[model samples]
Target: MTKPTETGFSAPEFLTVDEAAALLRVNRKTLYELIRLTQLPGVLHIGRSIRIRRDALLAWRPGNGGPALGESR
Candidate 1:
């Protein structure tokens, strides 16, 4: 059974870089850069792979005080 998320909808608990990038309408490289800079939250590093929590992504917004996308920290 699918569980309701904080966003009031059901989504995958984790998202791959490509999946996340698509959702954010950004390039995969840009997403990687955000992850590398530790700007985006809820990043999980599993071996050589990376995963992002859907709830965290849904909660994130530029107005939340995070750096603007593509801006250097």
Candidate 2:
């Protein structure tokens, strides 16, 4: 069973690129770059669309040890 996140989304919930970018407070381009580099986790390709798992997105940290959340990158 999936647990509910603070946003009321279940752990298994999928978020669009816009939604995921908004949650991370980053621009869509940045998110897309991460996707392009295969840095982001839980990325799913459905047809020509993309979906990211809410849980995986929330748990992700910059693999390169980039700036902390809420700080300028």
Candidate 3:
């Protein structure tokens, strides 16, 4: 698990749909498509937003995983 620095930013973190999409470098729709296909991992559906755990993303691929915004197969 990752812990936040003094600035406070780390794993188990929360990101907006747009932010997550950006992290994956894809558009929001594409991200949704990935979610629809169940290709992305560790995505949580909160009341109104789709969230991905930062640690999960990091572990999936160290130093930037490939297009992980979408759900995983």
Q: Which stretches of candidate 2 lie over 4 Å from their true place?
A: 1-3, 6-12, 63-73
Q: On residues 32-56, what C-alpha lDDT tens digit does candidate 3 reach at each position?
A: 8767766667789888768887656
TM, every model: 0.74, 0.72, 0.60
lDDT of each: 0.86, 0.84, 0.68
How many steric clashes between backbone atoms does each model show? 0, 0, 5
Could you say which candidate leads in TM-score? 1
**Best candidate according to lDDT:** 1
lDDT of 1: 0.86
How big is the positional error of residue 70 in model 3, measured in Å on the Cα after superposition?
12
Candidate achieving higher TM-score, 2 or 3: 2
Candidate 1 per-residue lDDT, tens place, 1-73, comes to 3468778987788999999999999999999998988888889999999999977987988464766767755
lDDT of each residue in 1-73, candidate 2, tens digit only? 5678779876647889999999999999989988876779999999999999988998987764765333555
